[model samples]
Target: MPTFTALTTLVGKDSAEKLGEAMERLTPEPTGVGVFEIEDGSGLWEVGGYFTESPDAAGLAVLAAAFDAKPFVVSELPETDWVAKVKRELAPVKAGRFFVYGSHDADKVPVGSEPLLIEAAMAFGTGHHGTTLGCLKALDRIAGEGFHGRSVADIGCGTAVLAMGAARIWPETVLASDIDEVAVEVAEANVSANGLTGQVRCVEAAGFGHPDLAAKAPFDLVFANILKAPLVDLAPEMGANIQAGGFAILSGILNEQADEVVAAYDAAGFDVHTREEIGEWTTLTLCHR
Candidate 1:
């Protein structure tokens, strides 16, 4: 398959964050599709955000039409290809079990003993994004403390990386949900691929407090790696769903946005547990009051 490049920028720093937040809504849905063709163990490939699947010739046009992006398809010299390009691009990220590449790296988790391999595609959760890594670290902290019989609710679970991490390290019961069906599908695939279907179940939910979630009230741990505004809006609901003394992990906030987000949690009855930062993003862990 031919490779493509989408080099678009948000209007400014603030706009960048807003754009990133908006793009998140498109994830876990078929908003984009990518195909990687490997030849001679390497080929030209691209990791672009797409809103729909169409003929290769039409992919760029579709992207241009659906979103404000500069989408252009590109190929390499006859011998050199996209896979090699991605490999080179991803090489620097090989520090841990997870390596995140590209601009959308905030949506995945790349931790734990077993390797979490996710191609940089239109899907979320490639272990490189700040939101994903921050949540991973928070999950690791919880797991390290030993989650014996705790119950976890992964809100806005995207690719279910947090759910899988909880299952891998803590053996806790996990319920992972995403607003996007495509995200749920990808999460299911990853969970199954990692042999975690029994511990983690992926489902679709518009947001917290959905009837189904209410049915599973009082989670020992609640994790949501969504943006700042939504986190604020869901604070009350999150506080209600978490059991007293349970842990709550919140992400998807830029470092500068951390305090405001944390205050929302505090006002909703969650006590500050710990806060960590990765690059421009921050992760806050709290205890439900």
Candidate 2:
């Protein structure tokens, strides 16, 4: 196994709390990767993590080379090869009947069930983050009740996990969209990998700005797992897109932020049904009024 080094800087103890909060929000896993923090004499601090893999060397080199051009006194940690390390932890993850795999060349989706292989990027909703898991649980809850063959939309469809989940749960078709083209690409790939390419379609859209966004009108089911601020900003449009008595799932909220998120939708005329929590994250289910 090859071992590569990583470096992280900190801006003093004063920034520790904020940095810690950011880390928690980011939730960078430290297995195939490990993170450590460093403090400079001037109170500035740097935190870094390393990947341990031989195959990942090329990718890591590209990342390291890019950092070399900058003169922020970037510290270089001991070299570690991480290809094998990441691969070991990147094993296929099975959740219920759905299968989630990494993006490496060795990343292969299971033949049975639904296979969703996503590039292991820094983006959330690779079906590994807590928010993603909460959304998945919320999805499972909605799936138990069934889709009633109604249309659905997965807003902020990072990797289109929930959308794919909906497609797998019911034969009903779903439209998934994301603001990031990269995420959309990953989502499209995942949809095809899962054999639900025909059922769940991915598109690029900034919020509800997609040209085809309005065409899916008054969807019977809507799932939006985004941050609190955007969730509040989208309240009006969310109300407009969901049909009366239809269901909507909202996630990407912290425990303390749940009520605020629920209030946003409540004011928009959604009646709260249930709020699901996993770890520090929360997912709320509501019915359009």
- Estimate every model's Cα lDDT from 0 to 1: 0.66, 0.68
- Alpha carbon RMSD to native, model 1: 10.5
Q: Which runs in model 2 stand beyond 4 Å of their true positions?
A: 1-86, 90-99, 102-115, 119-123
lDDT of 1 by residue, 142-179 (tens): 65676543777899988787777677656666889999
Number of clashing pairs, model 1? 21
lDDT (Cα, 0-100) at 97 in candidate 1: 35
Ten contiguous residues minimizing lDDT sum, candidate 1: 37-46
**Cα-based lDDT at residue 150, candidate 1:** 72
Of the candidates shown, which would achieve the greatest TM-score relative to the real structure?
Answer: 2
TM-score of each: 0.65, 0.67
* TM-score of decoy 2: 0.67
Model 2 residue 10 CA deviation in Å? 15
